[model samples]
Target: MSKLSEKASEYLSREERLNVLSTSNKAGENNIAVFGSVMAVDDSTVMLMLGENTTCANLRENPRAALLVYVPGKGGLQAEGCRVYLRLRAMEDTGERFEQIKAGIRARVGDAADMLKHLAIFEVLKVRPIIDLGQEI
Candidate 1:
């Protein structure tokens, strides 16, 4: 159970934003997808929506991922820019925490979110900030 910094946590949950999820299989095939359902389970832990597809399969083979999350300017030139590179280690389980994650997905997206089956439970290994020029604008 790892936790993210307060700032990182706030950024992830501030609004539903798109992030890039990159994973690779044991054979080294790259898989990338745009995910918007990322959320911090707590401070050091995060959860993502997994579909029955390539991204999930990649994680099944290699439980590692790098998620790129960037927040665009809020108003024209005033919003501060923030970008993060998140290192994650994922697992599949139906344990208590997984259930909590399931509950969260349903709560956020409603019953239509049932397409989610397995929980890509991940621990935040690292949080690297990437400076963007837009923020300085």
Candidate 2:
């Protein structure tokens, strides 16, 4: 597995950022959803709390996915962002990790935590600039 670059890691840590997870089913039907429960567990891993929805179902059907993280700028490609390719590593509905994530969600968004049904763990496959101008992440 490859590691995330320092810049990419920093961008993923931004509190005021946008995260959109893209996944496709076994038949290649695509799905994208805005997520607020995403966090970089380290440079090589990311974790998310997901309900039993299309996103979770798609990941189970096809492990490949991508997370587009963006931190808005005044305007243009100069914006801070990166496209993080990921592979589903694990999905746990019960465990220490799940409980921890559940508590975190409760603290941040109260009742929204009740909707969390799975703790999704993913391995970072690659990271690229949002515009993909042949620039390094």
Candidate 3:
């Protein structure tokens, strides 16, 4: 079992959803977007669906991304201060690791099982948590 960082666990447990930021190369430039169906696969890895879209295209070119998961309700912006940035490397769609991620997603969002069946899964290669406990403003 992979143990997630204290910060990562806290964030995941508190927020049921995450915004995945995927960047792709477009004519030698970067394009980024916020994806809503992101899932936490263990403590270190984050999983999300990459449909046949620009975000997926960008990932194929450059498998790096950052994810921001905000706690729901009031003061959500303050929660943004604790977003997690990840260095991602696309994993091949085979083997046990892939299965593990699939299972993880199912466990997190059982209600969306039908929707997830059509989405492609990507994993986080590295994660960095940003927490501004000292910031007053």
Highest TM-score, which number? 2
| TM-score of every model versus the real structure | 0.72, 0.96, 0.57
Off by more than 4 A, model 2: none
lDDT (tens digit, per residue) of candidate 1 on 7-97: 6676787675557888899999999897767877787777787768898888878877877766765645434323433444655556786
Residue pairs that clash (backbone atoms under 3 angstroms), model 2: none
Q: lDDT of each structure?
A: 0.69, 0.91, 0.55
* lDDT (tens digit, per residue) of candidate 3 on 1-137: 13346666566665454564747564556666666556666666666664466776766677665566655554633444245555554544556755565566668767554443334444545444444555421
Runs in model 1 lying further than 4 Å from the true structure = 1-3, 74-100, 107-112, 132-137
Over 2-32, each residue of candidate 2 has an lDDT whose tens digit, in order, gives 7889988888888889999999999999999
Report how far residue 81 has shifted in candidate 3, in Å.
Answer: 6.5
By descending lDDT, how would the candidates be arranged?
A: 2, 1, 3
- List candidate 3 segments past 4 Å from native: 1-4, 13-18, 26-28, 92-137
Q: Give the worst 10-residue stretch by lDDT in candidate 1.
A: 128-137
Clashes of 2: 0
Two-way TM-score contest, 1 vs 2, winner: 2
